[model samples]
Target: DQQVKQNSPSLSVQEGRISILNCDYTNSMFDYFLWYKKYPAEGPTFLISISSIKDKNEDGRFTVFLNKSAKHLSLHIVPSQPGDSAVYFCAARPGSQGNLIFGKGTKLSVKP
Candidate 1:
């Protein structure tokens, strides 16, 4: 079974609205979670991250929330803009390894 999963294959939002993405994990060993935004032909770039120790971490309009007990996490982007349209990936790293397990990204379309 995949350790990480993004149930929604895609999401759409109007510019200046909020975009919410969800993710789930099966591995309890994961300690660090991260979100990445990817553009076509380009590699995924880091967006936001949160540790299992914290329930929430925010960076400006991007925020990551982790629910350790439920093995779930989510990313929220406020004021979504057309430029923000891209694939959003959810990743997790086990406490002992540097390798990250990534979910099949959720494509986000921010319509103008």
Candidate 2:
């Protein structure tokens, strides 16, 4: 079973603070991890990604870390802004088709 789990269905953060979201996976075959940000009624856009080969990856305000041993991953957003409010999904792929198995999602709300 390729189930990716986001324990927190939602999170709230004050503007300009750091926001952290967590995810876990049950499939050991999953080696590539990705995080996607989505707004209402729109497709998710890729935020950051990490291969099983690496433990951490970062891009400006967003960072993602993967722990292969624990089968867990997390996304961090610093100085969270109101504009950053949206649903975030964690995904994993086995390095072939690039087809993803997604977590239910975590909705982040940044209050101004």
Candidate 3:
């Protein structure tokens, strides 16, 4: 069974608008959350991350929020640009382990 899930396979948003991507986890052992953005013909790159102890973490136009009780997390991109279009992967690290479980990923298209 997949521990991390991104129910929406894709999302579309207009330029200068906000893009929200949702992720859900089935394991309570997850202690950290990470978001990765992947462009075509390229590897996934780390975007923003949040610890389980905190509810939110922000970096420039990117922000990640975690709800421990609900085992859910979301990534918000403000004023999205066409360059932001890519596949976003939600990953969770269990406890202090180095391994991370990744979701199927949600393809985000920021239209101009």
- Tens digits of per-residue lDDT for model 1 on 24-112? 99999998999999999999999998988999999999988899899999999998989999999999998856699999999999999
Comparing 1 with 3 on lDDT, the higher-scoring candidate is: 3
lDDT of 3 at 112: 99
How much is 75 displaced in model 1, in angstroms? 0.4
Candidate 3: Cα lDDT at 56: 95
* Candidate with better TM-score, 1 vs 3: 3
Residue 92 in candidate 3, Cα distance off native in Å: 0.3
- Stretches of candidate 2 off by over 4 Å are none
Candidate 3: minimum summed lDDT over ten consecutive residues — where?
A: 92-101
TM-score of each: 0.96, 0.94, 0.98
Model 2: pairs clashing at backbone N, Cα or C within 3 Å: none
Candidate 3 — which pairs collide?
A: none
Deviation in Å, model 3, residue 105 alpha carbon: 0.3
Candidate 3 lDDT by residue in tens digits, 67-91: 8889999999998999999999999
Q: Roughly what TM-score does model 1 have, to 2 decimal places?
A: 0.96
The clash count for each model shown is: 0, 0, 0
What lDDT score is found at residue 10 in candidate 3? 99
Give one digit per residue, the lDDT tens place, for model 2 in 1-112.
Answer: 5489999999999999999999999888888999999999999998999998999999999999899889999999998999999999999996667688899999999999
lDDT of each: 0.94, 0.93, 0.96
